[model samples]
Target: MIESLESHPPQPRPIRWWVRACFGLTSPVGQRLYFYTGVGLMAVKYIVEAGFIRLMTGRTLTLLDFVNPLLSSRMQLLQGAPDWAGWALILWSLPFLWIAASMSIRRSADAGLSPWPGMLVLLPIINLPVMLLLAALPHREVERPYGETLGADDVSAAGSALWGIAGGVATGAVAFAMSVLLLESYGAVLFLSTPFFVGAVSAYAYNRPASRDAGSTLAVVMLSVLLSASALLLFALEGFICLLMAMPLAALMAPLGGLIGKAIADQCRGRRSHAMYAVAALPLLAALEFFVVHPHVREVQTSVEIDASPQIVWQNVIAFPDLPEPTEWYFRAGVAAPIGAHIEGHGVGAVRHCRFTTGDFVEPITVWDEPRRLAFDVTEQPEPMFELTPYHEIHPPHLHGTMRSLRGEFRLIELPGGRTRLEGSTWYLLAMWPQEYWIPFSDGIVHRIHQRVLEHVRDVSERSNGPPSRH
Candidate 1:
């Protein structure tokens, strides 16, 4: 009778209280409440914060103004946020979803199904009902396989501890790199899009079976082609265009890519699963295509005409220290200045240091261009406040050793109407972070700063011959 029982499937077990609670919480009504409440709270926060920023600035916030700070730390008006706040948010959010999924999986396991089937939560439009069904299902208690009779609590505790350690390290590394990129003035959009890759990988790993599906194969191939094309287009366009174009393209491609990956997996079923091999080969293919076919750097220029004579503007620029007053906001903020005090050389090899100050915080200049440009190679920064978690300690790197180059510049061109075209541009090669992670933020902030400086210069220079009228 025991042998017969073993051969027969185990009977379904009663659901535990905890499992029941999880099921209740993930019900359609509960999920709707959570989603809507979260959105409402986020909306409220944005509105309140935006209002406060506008009130402080005495000007209505433009979309760019509001978004710029969030995108680039260099533009951030908030003085004392922890460097790791962003990373911490990411870390904290992950465990919540993982736990919820685990509970759902447990409920599914009680229904005498493979835990892998719980991954249906990843499917679009179908996940809600699937999760609900999984949650509502009764649990089944079965005898454990040999060597698998460990205490549940102990196993869970060990897994949790491991996950925490790994998560902390990963979060810290990502935060550090992200902070560096933000400081360099990259955009936040690309950083925000990283979850798509995560989703795609998850789908590829979980949804593909050994069976071949034509639809899935077509989806994957088409998605890969679309993503590759979009990436190529972005590389070919200017920064702003790249940003504008890449966002919608990414949004469209990510879900499609996930579905395609799933389809590809399904197609390979019973045909000697090529999914693993495909995944392995993808990186190699990407690397080859990126390095050999793509242009990593393309240069472009713009000119802004200043009303002042080239010689006069050049004098003011070269003799920036002797100027009557600080004309630009950056200059007023003590972030940058004319060539005299900061730089020693008038040409390429001349070394000068420019300083950026925000209240008590100051960034030292590592590279100074005489008569034209200045660059701050940020070597180190103070430890962010929130990184002082009990579980892990973060130490700020020493500035002297950590300095990578930050580049900035100005160009002077003689124009008609006794005017000079003062074209300003800056460039820096980012290190300590993936270029994809922070380049958009960097570009947006740099562009804003450049625009501000030029506008200020134009305003001051244009009004120099008369009493400055308020615009």
Candidate 2:
């Protein structure tokens, strides 16, 4: 009877491409995720994008500049010369979105969670954290018809960990290379997407039976660090800076990625199952790069009501002394906080040099209505900020041209009480995508820059008597 029971363990029908069981992602049942399924899908996406970019620009994409949707202005697509890449990418992306949403809904239901969260599948870039979190959830104890629990014997950690990490590292490295080679960008590639790869590797590391939480956590961190270090050594990415910069970034993202990877791997029958989800993410990633991470112009304006008149405020606006040492952590941590301002002339056509720690922003006066308005075009841009880490100098891409300051203006509005509402405004374009994440930091930095100058103006204007009344 025992021999018969051993031979008669609960069995299900053989898996097929159109198998009903395959449609639902989550199940207590086991299913095999065929090898290379994930990679093949990603390749399809790469070909489509490369073709579109090449057709639109008459040049293949390169590892030159930040190549995200933000770089494609409507002028490139709608206005003067229509570059078809935008519309091409958009229309082609719909089917992939459908697939992602469907998979998410199935995955959510299998998790014993509502499918509503699966709505995140439709959102790009941001949806990664949500889905990864979902992936980390353990299966419900109660079994449904999905295929008998993943079977007690899963791939041992000893066997799967190294394989998963190696595969995940290669995958993430490839993705990074694609971002640079295929898209010519880094922010979304590194900060936004790499975590998943780290997670994949970590997931593999934790795949064994009876895994310890702390040990697993350390394993994930070490694997993520290794992945980052390897990128520098093998691929010529950010070099030593990655030890502190990339490692911290990896530490923040890899643990999460690992959990999700593990969850995906656990749900599937084979050790390589996580790649399927990673592959599916490629289309979503593309959608994000083009639509969600698309670049847009951002303007920041900050105003302060000063006790003195416009003439007094205007005097200091043209030229100011050194700023007090920065107390804010953001500034101290190497963001190029404003130091002072001094100009070569008094009116329109004069050159104004605004100094920051990294370097000076050369602003040539464009409009000057004495005591009321002062506008200037940023003729020369400087590094956006510096990394605080000990180094003679660091040159991160975003610091170079990814963030550009186009123009700036000061509007001095005379208030009722001899007070002047001194408004300092800056127009800029952040080349990076994932605006929702980066905007807050950019906005705050701009505000502080404005504040440093405006507050200095307020102090000097109020500190001294009113400027000689201009006719």
Candidate 3:
């Protein structure tokens, strides 16, 4: 039976927009108002936060850090900042959270979707798509009411799924070509935004013909991402290790696109131009990123205590024998492992050759403080990895010089009882976006390399002397 609102009069619109939007939980929200207001408020929030962060620390907060404000607590920029600043950022987010939740819940109901999905706004990263999807969905007609679920029968569902997956795959392929083939760069647009756009397009395609429940919609989106990824492998565009490394990123970004796509399909049932506009914008953004984005040098340091004195350790540090076969799986899986070290001359002007599994790093000695400090600038370095591909040899662009070793240094400190402290620091450049995510991988590999060399030095130094003499 159809319900009638004829007998009951509607509530008057509140004068203050905040009361209407933030506190108007029981009322329905229109799609345009929801999207625009959400975007406008978010922009304002960023402006305020950016100004505050800059004022407090004289440091600009990256988009990744600003998106998730909780990161402020752990950020180095906020280290010396007043305790109230961090707390203030946290407190500032509360009202926005309230506004988001309240708006999402109402918007979901208004769009004929269940209000439960609205709570997803609380989750980091995932909430972005949820909000976008909610905003994309058109408000349900007044007669349809809020409790109804939207979907077609199984036959239509299958057809939509197939089309959705195809659409998503095509979107991903195009994005891959534009970013990799044309731009020849792997920025966030390729790794992060593409998957999201693909997912969104897939979900939108799936629901365009006939709306599916959120579960079926998400399932289709996942399958689309999987199929698109498999296509890269099938066509030999990417290797297994690279794809495996990228899966987490793709998986993290895609579903939200699907959610929003599905919402858009359900609400604005006839808009074909919207998807086209999005598709067109992606390549332009990639081109802009190519011109604007540049990699920054990051340093990784590792230290080990040796049983022998600095004099003994210095001998091994300057030139070490071949390391034993690496037992670690990462090394076996093609990550470069240090092989040995050899020097051409004895002093500051000498050249050092550090051999790795892939090739050699040519280092020109800049400092030669015997038994104290040794530093060198890496003039030339070999490929970082050998891709585990089915093909005999595939030289991907990233393998060439994306991860570059700029310089390295070894510090030796004399310790009590004829001991030494050896510290190895490598400064390198990585051209990967969301540095927070990729830095760990590079840091971990660098640390392992440092450990291997340091341990070898320790062992060699210990063997040089008959035995350690305790005073």
The TM-scores, one per candidate, come to 0.35, 0.62, 0.74
Give the worst 10-residue stretch by lDDT in candidate 3.
Answer: 1-10
lDDT of each: 0.37, 0.58, 0.75
In model 2, the runs with Cα more than 4 Å from the true position are: 1-25, 28-159, 180-184, 187-189, 205-260, 270-293, 466-471
- Best model per TM-score: 3
- Quote the lDDT for 433 in model 2: 40
Model 3: per-residue Cα lDDT over 241-306, one tens digit each:
888988877776687667666666665554322566556666776776677666666677889988
Candidate 1 per-residue lDDT, tens place, 1-471, comes to: 224333544345355743444333222212222233333433554575556545444334454543332232221332222334333333333333343343433344445454334543432223455655664454455443111212212223234333323322232223223433323222222222232332334344443323224344334433443444343334332122323433453444345434433433332222332323222322332232223321122112235677776555554443234224446553453222322224444544544443233111122445444434433433332211112122332223312122222344457766666666787655434322223323443343345545654655665566663433332
Model 3 accuracy (lDDT, Cα)? 0.75
Candidate that would win on lDDT: 3
- lDDT string for model 2 (430-469, tens) is 7654443445556668888898889888888887964523
| Number of clashing pairs per prediction, in order | 22, 7, 3
Angstrom error of the Cα, residue 372, model 3: value is: 1.0
Off by over 4 Å in 1: 1-201, 204-250, 265-274, 282-300, 319-341, 344-350, 357-411, 414-417, 426-446, 462-471
lDDT of 3 at 376: 99
Worst 10 residues of 1 by lDDT: 145-154
